[model samples]
Target: MNAKVRLGEFLLTRRSQLRPEDLGIPDYGERRRVPGLRREELASLAGVSVSYYTRLEQGQSLNASPQVLDAIARALRLEEAERLHLHNLARSSAADPGRRRSPAPERVTEATRQLLEALAHVPAILTGRRSDVLAWNRLGHALFAGHLDPGAPERPAQRPNMARLVFLDAHTRDLYADWPAKARAVVGHLRLVAGRHPDDTALHALVGELSAKSADFASMWADHRVMACTVATYRMRHPLVGPLTVTQQTLSQDPSLGQNIVVATTEADSPARTTLALLDQVTPQHGPARPTVRAGSG
Candidate 1:
């Protein structure tokens, strides 16, 4: 996706989400054709000319100052994550256009592998920038993708992408009690990454693939929402272990790695914890019974 177009879409989406009444603008009972505040109204509130705001939203204004972006962000009432995303999108577009860089190879370091191994009982997976499962512990495999071939992550062609699984894989979809919420979170996090890594071709390809395959993904992508997922609680239904609630924490290893270790844990002494322990017992420590990571089908 082009960075300018992304910035424009982000601005447009956020603008439409804010209602005039919420921002103390009097509507005067006028029949409105557009949702939320009009372009002029937003520009007025943001202390900018309507023409300038329009140019920014049309991708014509590439040199937006940080102060100007912040003013617009305030007018739109964007959350902290969304505000950061807006700045990233603008900054990406403002960078030297002549230079280009290839996406980094997605791989888990030996040290990260050792970390996953140390947390044998915890359902934990190491993911690359595209949410590709680079590696996972035995328990994580059993908990998240037990139906797929366990050795799939070892093959780059067969690595399972969490975003793809959330939207397209029926087994993974069924595992989540709140499937829609999970899907939205995936899209939001992907948007955040897209803003920060605008030159990532792999990410753009993944987004294209998902947009073509899943209507839900397409709609969410069009909305241009942005989010950084650090911690979340989710309800999951395991075929073997029944229902359980787990909190997922995303830990960043190295800044340059662009990878996260997603670890899921249940409450202490809770029934879900007991169920997870049982799952660990039934799942082999190291063997042919590993979790399968299938290539997502279109």
Candidate 2:
């Protein structure tokens, strides 16, 4: 959780990935002893002394400036998200003692709910930081968790996670036609979440449970893979309906709950769209009303 250690691990991981030629470093046979750029090479690239870089990598250095972090990030070729994570790790290191940062509260704001209502035609749901289903449009329930209790409002305690459903729930397993692809995404998403919320107790608990209960999940989790998934397309086989080519987009609500709003939409005039519309029409009439009083707005 400490910045220096996180930075070191990140640098180590990234360094192991690039070869000498990849960074224009001459590599004569017997000139290299390790797989990645050495500490000296990395320090040279970042315009830092070998001793300083070594100390940082060993978690002995603290309070790394943003400028130094940027240099290191560039040296390691970190992505934007990774760079941000690096900054977060560094900045959080200097947190004042006795200061407790409560977990970021998650909720569905009135405006967000209105937006969902407006996009009622699309299958959309708002999820918390832990991937807890917070709220869903009528079609969203049908598209994703149609079998769950529609009457039960999406909340932190009662909400079913998309990752849990994809990997842990048998009903969800059967719901996805291309289960393997969906499974990879689930793990990748979890990886991304873990990287961001390394201190999230609930997230760690979820990961531990999934790793213990599901062998497939355990296998993927060991790979140490991380990815930021904002959009994806998938082929899903709905039991009530049939195959669907759906595109998933994740929206973040700022100054609210930071909840991720994921919406799945089919191609224009596609059978899936028609099926979704039909589902929306039939679901509310047949099932109980979806509970609205779930999260505390405050």
Task: After the best TM-score superposition of candidate 1, give how far the Cα of residue 189 lies from its true spot, in angstroms.
Answer: 0.5
Clashing pairs in 1: 148-292, 149-292, 150-291, 150-292
Measured by TM-score, how close is model 2 to the native structure? Answer: 0.81
Candidate 2: worst-modelled 10 consecutive residues by lDDT: 285-294
Residue 165 in model 1: lDDT: 96
Local error of candidate 1 at 70, Å? 1.1
* RMSD of candidates 1 onward, in order: 4.8, 3.8
RMSD of model 2, in Å?
3.8
108-176 in candidate 2: lDDT tens per residue? Answer: 678977887788678888777767887777778888888898645543567788888888888889877
Q: Write the per-residue lDDT of candidate 1 for residues 139-228, one digit (tens) a residue.
A: 889999999877778778989999999999999999999988888889999999988889988899999999999999999989888777
lDDT of each: 0.89, 0.75
Using Cα atoms with residue i matched to residue i, what is each candidate's TM-score against the true structure?
0.94, 0.81
Clashing pairs in 2: none
Clashes within 3 Å, all models in order? 4, 0
On lDDT, the leading prediction is: 1
